[model samples]
Target: MRRPYFDLIATGAKTIEVRVGYAKICKVAVGDSLRFTSSDGSLFTRITAVKEYKSFDEMLDAEDNTGIGEAGMTRDQLLAACRDIYPPEKEALGVFALHLAPLPE
Candidate 1:
């Protein structure tokens, strides 16, 4: 199974700042770097800065394997991909549909 992870939208996002709990992940830190290609096919780097921490927000394991690395799958790309995969059904419950449905809502 693909590891479940969060994709911070690059749209209107000045910089890809991943909050690993309270501490923000940075590129220069001694951390693991992950390469990602946006939906526009732009090459970008993602770094997992914080390794160990205790916080209220769910923490992502640096070693946890997860990614949908299709070319041109930037934040927007992923959203589109997901929408295509799980399109809205005609007779779906409005409430449940809202929750299970993909982003871009």
Candidate 2:
């Protein structure tokens, strides 16, 4: 099977003894633009901002679990694709936050 759009990898944090990747809006780097596509083939673009995590451990946890990519979709691209496929999922979260599915690599 191919890997998903994004792969969340967890590495040990200095403060915490364990390693993990937790899902947070801040995972995406600041200044980067994310383009998402809807199920009906609509496109939406937004710039990512800096999102802070309570602790390094929490950040690691989200990264460790996040994964998406396949059929030529990067993590961001996959998210865009998923946005199109599942618009309603993110409607409640706000216009910016999207429930993107990880693409398979």
Q: Best TM-score goes to which candidate?
A: 2
TM-score of each: 0.22, 0.24
Q: Which ranges in model 2 have alpha carbons more than 4 Å from their true place?
A: 1-27, 54-105
Give residue 91's error in model 2 in angstroms.
18
> To one decimal, what is the Cα RMSD in angstroms of model 2 from the true structure?
15.7
The residue pairs that clash in candidate 1, if any, are 38-72, 38-73, 38-74, 39-72, 39-73, 39-74
lDDT string, candidate 2, 13-105, tens digits: 111111112344435544444433333333233333343334332333344223222334444554455445445434333222222322222
Model 1: per-residue lDDT, tens digit, 1-105? 122222332332222322222222222343334343444433244343333323211122222212332433455554444444434441121101000112222
Reference-based lDDT, each prediction: 0.29, 0.32
Runs of candidate 1 exceeding 4 Å displacement: 1-31, 46-48, 52-105
